[model samples]
Target: MPGLNVLAGDLLNVMRFYTRLPLPVFRFEREAHALPDFRRAAWAIPVTGAVVGACGALAGGLAYLAGLSPLIAAALALAMQVAITGAFHEDGLADSCDGLFGGASRERRLEIMKDSRIGTFGGAGLFFALLLRVLALAELFRLMGPAALVLLPGIAALSRAVALMPVLLLPPAGSQGLAASVPLPGLPAWLLATGIGAIIHAVACLWLDLPLGGLVSGGLALMLMPALAALARRKIGGHNGDILGGCQQVAEIALLLALSSAANWRGPL
Candidate 1:
């Protein structure tokens, strides 16, 4: 009984770290077992990736079973995250775009992202990002058949993992928020986990016989995220929690597009 209790507590700690829920302290607290410090939170990236991905897979499956379009499935997946995390990331993506592109200086950019108010850039960015995702998902649905439901989660995990790459490599723009609490994980640890996660995602993609086109598109989407992060770092001078979230959202859309294309071109290779 004690052993089971300990395992449950550890799982809760992991859940709290990955999701938006605040666990009851006694139920899941362990200062030593808490997520790696903010600096090393990169280690938790893959874990978070898997959780979000699992959610996406579930939602995507339901969407398919309901005979809904791929776009609906994709949107449903997005909706699930918004429900779970309070749109924390979607908000970040919008804010980062508004501030970075709309402002003249790093300070201004950061200030813009911080404001709860939405600007033209932010609104437009959100619209386009959501649209891209919907369209990409629809395309993927048409191409991948039912296996897409399973593959979607793997892609989600990979996208989140991709977002962590930037966080691990760059300094935070602010000293607060969840990122502040996350610790920098060791390079060796991060690399090993990331490699394993990548292998799993890749194996899943290959199993689906996804087309080269989809793979390229999806891989490009993942690559674009870090590039955006690099740009955000340079333009805004550093990363914030919001920017990190934006990267995850963008990467997921890109992956869906790539995988969709691959499925159409090669029928899951």
Candidate 2:
């Protein structure tokens, strides 16, 4: 079994990589060495997602408690999440859109993705993605009220966990950037991450006594990951940080939409 210190270090490393949190610098030489190797620490991704999700949930809950409308509360939650993460995943989604649709060749697509400028396709993608998330979240808030706190974090964890699939299954699309630097995590790491996400979500579902619609939404999100990975491979050859980020965004939106639609049908939890 891993010691608490080891787990803590892994969690810190994950946070440093995944979020904009101002975590304290690790002074230990061993910790520093361990920090950059994402392959060994990939299992901590779900834990990182949980932290991000918790922050979003807290912001949304607070806004809801302040008597804001559900729509406003949901928007605040998403804004807070984007602010916390520096819009990292959303940026990837835009890049993926621009590259996948804007370019005529694989090389051209890769170049488009690498560029910082957002094109028409990228802008439209971001607009639609944000709109879908906001609408789904608003519906969830309307049905579940504060119960959305539990559901959002679960969805976040699951989305990140699913994002790992691309890294594990596909080669890097390019010879440089984040995908090339980090080694792909092995099966054990993937299993550990998946288990953590599943348990977190399953517990939330059981504790909340979520309806059949909620379960269906979660299940569909999980199913979408592989299809997304396949599409990425077919389009650009393989996966990258941008691809993984796009996967997470896609999964989150799908889950939220399903949950929100279900909530509308089933009424409040």
Candidate 3:
């Protein structure tokens, strides 16, 4: 049962860190020293993401059942996700955009990212990101109807899994932030996390009988991870919490867009 306890603790830790849910309180003294163990529990990240996505899917499905338009249902679903995650990834995307575009140098970029205030670039990034997600989800709903329920959760899991790439590949940019403070997961942990994510997607595909369009969309999103990590490396020196967030946002949007276009090309899967 000790192994089960550890697994349970790790899953709770991921949920506590990533979401706004009111989970059961953990033992403070034990958990404070267990940071390294929790970090190594990167494999549970996709599980947390699945929970978040499920919440969004539930919200969207309910809205659709209540006679809301696809657009409105999609917006509510995205809003539900933002609420559940506390907009953590969205904040990261905004900060990364501000730093990457507004700052003149790498150091300056990092500085801009550190600032609590959002700037023009950050505002624009958030706007477009939210817009794209809403539109894409609406399109998916219009085309696939209820099938989006399963596909969205899988996409969410996959996006979070991809964010681990930056953490695995790049060193922390500084000594003070989240990336530095948290222990980086090694190859085994990464493999476990990604493996879980892939399994989730594969199962969903088979269960839903997803078409080529759905498969292609997921493939494209997966491919974006390494490229985004490479760009983050060149732009701001290395991966930080913000960079991870940015990766999640980009992956989510890319997946959604691909899904949207696929919906147009192929009839419901």
RMSD of each: 3.9, 1.8, 2.2
Identify the leading candidate in terms of lDDT. 3
**Which candidate has the highest TM-score of all?**
2
Per-residue lDDT for 171-219 in model 3, tens only? 7887878767877777788778877876776676556555565577667
RMSD in Å for candidate 2, one decimal?
Answer: 1.8
CA displacement after TM-score superposition, residue 24 of candidate 3 (Å): 0.9
Error of 3 at 106 (Å): 1.5
TM-score of each: 0.81, 0.93, 0.93
lDDT of 1 at 3: 63
User: Which regions of candidate 3 fall more than 4 Å away from where they truly are?
Assistant: 26-29, 32-39
In candidate 2, stretches whose alpha carbon ends up further than 4 angstroms from where it belongs are 26-29, 32-35
Model-by-model lDDT, in order?
Answer: 0.68, 0.81, 0.82
Q: Which wins on lDDT, candidate 1 or candidate 2?
A: 2
Could you tell me how far off, in angstroms, the CA of residue 18 lies in candidate 2 after the best superposition?
0.5
Candidate 2 local lDDT, 182-225, one digit each (tens):
76687788778877876776676666666575578668877888
**Cand. 1 Cα-lDDT:** 0.68
Candidate 1, superposed: residue stretches over 4 Å from native:
1-11, 21-28, 31-43, 211-222, 267-269
